[model samples]
Target: MVDVTELQRQHIEKITKEKKLITIKECSTLTGIGERKLRELVHVSGFPCIRFGKKCMIVSSLIDEWLINHIGETF
Candidate 1:
């Protein structure tokens, strides 16, 4: 039988990688940045985050732009 579990995992991974808006945890994983630092960044002005009540989502596409804009700078 085909390994449905492995297939499902692969599918999920593909979906997450293709996602435009992702949770803080996913953003940390994708950017190799620690969750703690990411949480702080989300609160900074012009950092680019969508808030839903207490839940916060990071825009995947803006990550690169943010990094480039902050080059040679520290938060």
Candidate 2:
């Protein structure tokens, strides 16, 4: 069971890294940020997200860029 959970985590990491767009839940998993936090961030100005109806998708590369750009900033 532990091994299976590890494999599932690895698979999620791979998908998060490889996919151009990822769901909020995937972003939360990848970033270790809560889904609720991600949902709030998605609504913030300049957050990198695409909305399809009520669902939101995050741009993976943009997240990287956002992280880089935020380096040294106090949260």
Candidate 3:
């Protein structure tokens, strides 16, 4: 059987290494935040983001920074 957690880690690593921007859904899944909450955070928190046409893209690096800043040593 496949280890789901490891698979998720691998996917995140791959995306980060590739410098791939992710959508709100993907970000929510990776960060365990709900879509509505993510949107509100982005709207209120001035989170780093890019909007291309109708789509919004969040950089993996920005997310990493936010995590490092917000999450304590427990992470």
* lDDT for predicted candidate 3 compared with the true structure: 0.76
Runs in model 1 lying further than 4 Å from the true structure: 1-17
Q: In model 3, where is the ten-residue run with the lowest total lDDT? A: 66-75
lDDT of 1 by residue, 11-64 (tens): 646746798788888777667789999999999999978999999998877877
Residue-wise C-alpha lDDT for candidate 3, range 38-64, written one tens digit per residue: 776665455777788867788767886
lDDT agreement of model 2 with the native:
0.83
Give the local distance difference test score of model 1. Answer: 0.83
Mind giving the per-residue lDDT tens digits that candidate 2 earns over 1-75?
Answer: 268878878988788678999998888877888998888888777889999999889998789788678779644
Worst 10 residues of 1 by lDDT: 8-17
| Residue-level error in angstroms, candidate 3, position 70 | 4.2
After superposing candidate 2 on the true structure, give the runs of residues whose Cα lies further than 4 Å from its correct spot.
1-9, 72-75
Model 1 alpha-carbon miss at residue 40, Å = 0.6
TM-score per model over all chains? 0.75, 0.74, 0.74
Q: In candidate 2, list every pair of residues with a backbone clash.
A: none
